[model samples]
Target: MSEQRADVIGLGMIGGGVAVSLARRGRVPVVYDIRPDAADHLAGVPAPLASPAEVARASDVVLVAVVDADQARTVLSGEQGLLSGARPGLVVVLLSTVAVPVVRELAETCAKAGVELLDCGVTPGDKAAENGLVAILGGAESTVERATPVLADFAKRVVHCGPLGAGMATKIARNVITYGTWRAVHEASTLAEAAGVDPAKLLTVIDAADPEGATLLSWQRMRLAGKPETRAMVPQVERLLDKDLAAAQDLAGRVGVAVPLVDVARKHGKETLEIRVREDA
Candidate 1:
């Protein structure tokens, strides 16, 4: 989209949203997803359809917006993986939030294959990704710059957090804030319910009175606004969100940092990341 040649895969939400955005910018974008009708919907949009390997061969910049680290690994390492067709000097940008070690491993693997790997995780909801207002945390400075113009297709601000896994670490740090806060609200609201108070009114106080009330205010408002949006109802994968807290805890434990406040929030994330609720709305 940003005057860069690119190819994209995974068209469900992450891939589809980004491809549509890129196609609008007049960039040549080829897209593919496992779903048969995935690319069909966009047939006339000028976003060409290609196999994963074909997409790899057709574009200089490749951005992966898959579901998990395994999906990333498979896209690159499987028999039908992109690596089957990827050439030297190709930069693969990862936008998923995965463990630090996993990304580090990806970097090493990419190097041997003559491919460059950059962890450039984006922060924002589904809509934000489409509008190109997402925050991008990249690993290397040079890789960050090399990928920035291309990344600008779906991100307005592309920043280098530091090195290889630093982008992921930074993303982990930020999620420790949002996911942690959401759990806090869940617990606080639950406590109010058990204490003989209407949970909604208690939640209202949190919404209307607290300073950081807007922290996960959207999550709350959506749930209350009728059948909530699946995403706004729950910001991220439960346990995956918990892992961010765990990562922070591991870091804090090593640095001799006494994070009293974070510990309180950790309990909420630990317990709630596993809860499942029926979407009433």
Candidate 2:
């Protein structure tokens, strides 16, 4: 329905899902991929075009969802790449999770071609076709505004994180939270199993205590909120954390279980909890 034309390069899981979602929303985008059969597996998505340049020529906003930096580089700047056909005002939304430096390098490349680039980090690749992604964007405010409508066709929520590279940085940081929590869970389950407790029982207790895992982020929320009461409680909380972690370590030793995660958690508990004890205290 919108006047702006949208296109997608790379019809992999994320890109294919995006194209399908857009088509379902009546915004069917022009798409391209190196593999000729890329669109065969994606219903509602039209056949892939001959090249990225062709897609770019037909689009106002182009979403690049290629796998890695090298592929991204090839698609954007290689022979017959998008820049070859891009108009001066075209906007390119990069959806790859590359390093911040790589993002900046790509942005510079786009800028040289008189095209604007926005780094967009997306989540839940499995939910992409259902329009369930959260698009975390980093670019100028005007550039983001120009691409939001097209992005909205595939993403349920769009967050403009900050200037260029911030989206990739935020995505990287978010991944740490996810993978770190997984390691913590692994250690906990291993410890429980070694201590003659069923890991399933430990899971039950954790679920009952925090169904949505709100406690996993409670400390971050408190620190961000900067509540006076939270600040005042930090010292006591840090002390309790040390004691609890030390107990876990002792238990792990007695049960002959390795708890490296717990050990790291204890070593950096204060930093993780954002605790800064006052000199007077």
Candidate 3:
């Protein structure tokens, strides 16, 4: 119905979801994927075009959701790739989670073809069809504005992080927080299980004490805010962290459970908490 035509390349979970979401909003995108049957898996999505180039030819904006950097490169530059059919002013929004370097490399390729590239990092792949994804984007402001309407069809919230590779960079950093916290929770669960406590109960206690998990980011928030009062409290917080981590290590030793995360946390207590000791102190 809208004048702006959009297409999708790749029909995997994320891509299929994007197509479905767009269709639900009355913007059934021209779709492409390597597998001939990819469209059958999605409702309201048309069958795949023969190649990425065909999809490009029919689209003003194309969202590429391939699995990795190599596939993305192929989709954009290989024979029958999108660039072969891309018209001037065509915008390609890459939704893959490749490295920052890879994003920049692909952006260069897109630029030479007179196509604009936006590195878009989407989260919670399972929610892609529900129009619940948060699109973390990086590109020139004008390019971002041009693609926002198509992007809005699938993403519930769109954050323009900065230029070029910033979206992928932010995604990588966010993944660190996600997986790092999982590792920390794994260690905690191990300790609790070794000490004859149910891991579920531990989770219950954690949820009850910090329902929103505010404590997880409190230290970083304080450090970032950099108020004099928060800075003054860092040393005390560092001491408390060291003491608690030491106790966890000791408890784990007694229980014969490995607390490697706790060990590392203790080792980097001051650094982790952003506490810098003054020379005079």
Per-model clash counts, in order, read 1, 0, 0
Candidate 1 residue spans exceeding 4 A from truth = 1-3, 42-50, 210-281
By TM-score: ranked, best first = 2, 3, 1
Query: Model 1 has how many clashing residue pairs?
Result: 1
lDDT of 3 by residue, 30-66 (tens): 9999999999979899999999999999999999999
lDDT of 3 at 280: 41
Instruction: Give lDDT tens digits, candidate 1, residues 1-281.
Output: 35568777777566666776676666647766776677566532444454678888887888787889898888888866787788998888887789999998888888887999888767674763365646456566776777777777767677777878888888888888787767766654554555556888976776677657564555445444545344443546555666766775676666555555556656776344332345554
Residue pairs in clash, model 2: none
TM-score of each: 0.70, 0.95, 0.94
Quick one: how many clashes does candidate 2 have? Answer: 0
TM-score of 1: 0.70
Which model is ahead, 1 or 2, in terms of TM-score?
2
lDDT of 3: 0.92
What is the alpha-carbon lDDT of model 2 when measured against the actual structure? 0.91
